[model samples]
Target: MSDEVHTEAHGQVAEPQEKLDPEVRARREAALKLVRKYGDPVLRSRALEIDRFDDALVDEVRRMGRLMHDAYGIGLAATQVGVMHRVLVYRTELEGSVAALVNPVLEWSSKDKESSEEGCLSLPGVSVEVERPVHVRVRALDERGQPILVEASGLEARVIQHEMDHLDGVLILDKTSRDQRKQAMRALREALEPRPAAA
Candidate 1:
């Protein structure tokens, strides 16, 4: 759920903000403003199960969807936005419609696993290669509180697992190789470091 397209060609490097269209850049900036960054305490805190399904919940889902789209992310978790509710919004396909899942549970997962590169909006500019199940069945409630079963494979399954990790305060860094974790930590530190004032 990084703020950049998830593709082999793009890999770890994100497109320079200056290279983006003005409007698109502005939207991304605005969306990132609402997302909790790597060092944010909220990003490490596990979310609580959502108990209420009201107008406010619906509104929050809508906001998350818009933010995900604007940030060029495939998925987003409530914790990523400083919300403690166990909710997530995602769209596996770049041009697909977004779906909201509340209190999602990983009902089943295939023994087959695959390793792929993953990025996070919270840890922008950092990508980690992690292994995950190739197929999964999730039981969750829709935004409206209705029970829903999602059987997904491939990219969809990966996206669901990624978002689920966010709910538990587990990050890609935690599941990557030691060297990659060290590299990601360095990048995070540099991102948090203060820059010299313009001369």
Candidate 2:
């Protein structure tokens, strides 16, 4: 294992990912819309297998990264954005570097599991305690469509498992304890309730 870093940049690396072809970009932007809870059903269905790594898919992945940043989110799955492709954008720190994983699969995980508070963008104003592996190894494709392997631990592992679950039609709620899930749902309902118009 080398500590040296790879100095490389993808077309969609920076903030503004070349807003080419205004009309086409706009349409793709719309297609990249975040799938809000109770509004999008694909979020609960298994994502379709990704067979092609074309420009369209790359663009969508980039736009999804942008959307995640725009919404102040650290991770997002393809199904959450109405794309049934095996894709996910994730970042470890808030407002930090973002990475995209295509057709990701967890190849291994440690037996030790730790519990932590987890939340999802789709389920706003709700957090649940969930237990997940302390470490994981995943095989996926990089932004450049190159195969890559990642070994993550602690929070990184947690985020990876969370996003990977989305690809398999699983949510944090499903992993939470029965009691915690119930409480989270109640709190979510309260948070989403509309308040009376201002006097």
| Per-model C-alpha RMSD | 2.0, 9.1
CA displacement after TM-score superposition, residue 128 of candidate 1 (Å)? 0.7
C-alpha TM-score for every candidate: 0.92, 0.79
Model 2: residue 140 alpha-carbon error in angstroms:
0.8
**Model 2 weakest 10-residue run by lDDT:** 1-10
TM-score, structure 1 vs. true: 0.92
After superposing candidate 2 on the true structure, give the runs of residues whose Cα lies further than 4 Å from its correct spot: 1-33, 194-199
Clashes per candidate (backbone, < 3 Å): 0, 0
lDDT of 2 by residue, 1-199 (tens): 0000111211021233254456645643453344556336787889876788788888988888777765546778888877888888888764579888888988999999988677777775566677888999999997568998999997778778888998998877788889988887887788667789999
Worst ten in a row by lDDT for model 1: 4-13
Model 2 lDDT at residue 74: 70
lDDT of residue 85 for candidate 1: 92
Whole-model lDDT per candidate: 0.84, 0.71
